[model samples]
Target: MPTALLDLILPPRCAGCGVPGALVCPRCAAELHGRPACRMPVPTPPGLPECWSAADYTGAARRAIIAYKERGRTALAHPLAG
Candidate 1:
């Protein structure tokens, strides 16, 4: 099975931190923190709807955005879009 092959060849590792034995190791994920959702909207110049963001464009969110946008990490687009 593919699962068996994966287990044999490449042990699970955290996507973010490369810790062994888990796709996303809890300890490393915990270190990547997110702030409270302030729910504020800053209007744009071209009359676009005010943008609502959960956290500021820094840290994990920023990296994720860059990865999804510039680096073509389309896998994250759907979940992040919402």
Candidate 2:
């Protein structure tokens, strides 16, 4: 379906908080940014390249990730990337 038509049928909401009119609201977007930190697992699996994340995986950030990966909120990719 065309994106415009789909949006009209089901308006986008903030993936993090369900706020109407945007894939992610300003407040939720803000929650997605933070100083980078290493996210290596405690067990340190073999060949697991060092991973890092900007925002801690909690609160709004966790919700947004769940929405994107498990709830079909693909529209959140851009905002989450930022």
Candidate 3:
């Protein structure tokens, strides 16, 4: 499979910091969880889906999303969901 071949050629790396070994490092993962809190939008957009954010969109959390989506690091979904 193309994915399998690519895996062999490229070592797994954290989507957050690009550290080889894991899809998302433990530290970056920890940043994704906390007491779930309600999030509001500025001016409160109409028909916005009710959702909660694990952390503010910055640093590791931001980078991880970009990596997972743009770089195809699907493995990050587990940690990002934490």
Question: Which candidate comes out best when scored by TM-score?
Answer: 2
Task: Give per-model CA RMSD.
Answer: 6.2, 2.6, 2.6
Tens-digit lDDT string for candidate 3 (1-82): 4543666788877777879887778887777675676777777889988767768767888898887788676666778776
Q: Which stretches of candidate 3 lie over 4 Å from their true place?
A: 1-4, 47-50
Q: How far out, in Å, is residue 14 in model 1?
A: 6.5
- How good is model 3 by TM-score? 0.70
Question: Ten residues in a row with the worst lDDT in model 2?
Answer: 2-11
Give a tens-digit lDDT track for model 1, residues 1-82: 4443565687754444556785445553443445545444445357565555655665545655665577554554544454
Every candidate's lDDT: 0.53, 0.84, 0.75
lDDT per residue for candidate 2 within 1-82, as digits (tens), equals 8544677799787777888988888898888998899988778989999899999888889999998788666777888888
For model 3, give the 10-residue run with minimal summed lDDT.
1-10
What is candidate 1's TM-score against the reference?
0.43
Query: Of models 1 and 2, which has the larger TM-score?
Result: 2
Roughly what TM-score does model 2 have, to 2 decimal places?
0.76
TM-score of each predicted structure versus truth: 0.43, 0.76, 0.70
**Highest lDDT model number:** 2
Count of steric clashes across candidates, in order: 0, 0, 0
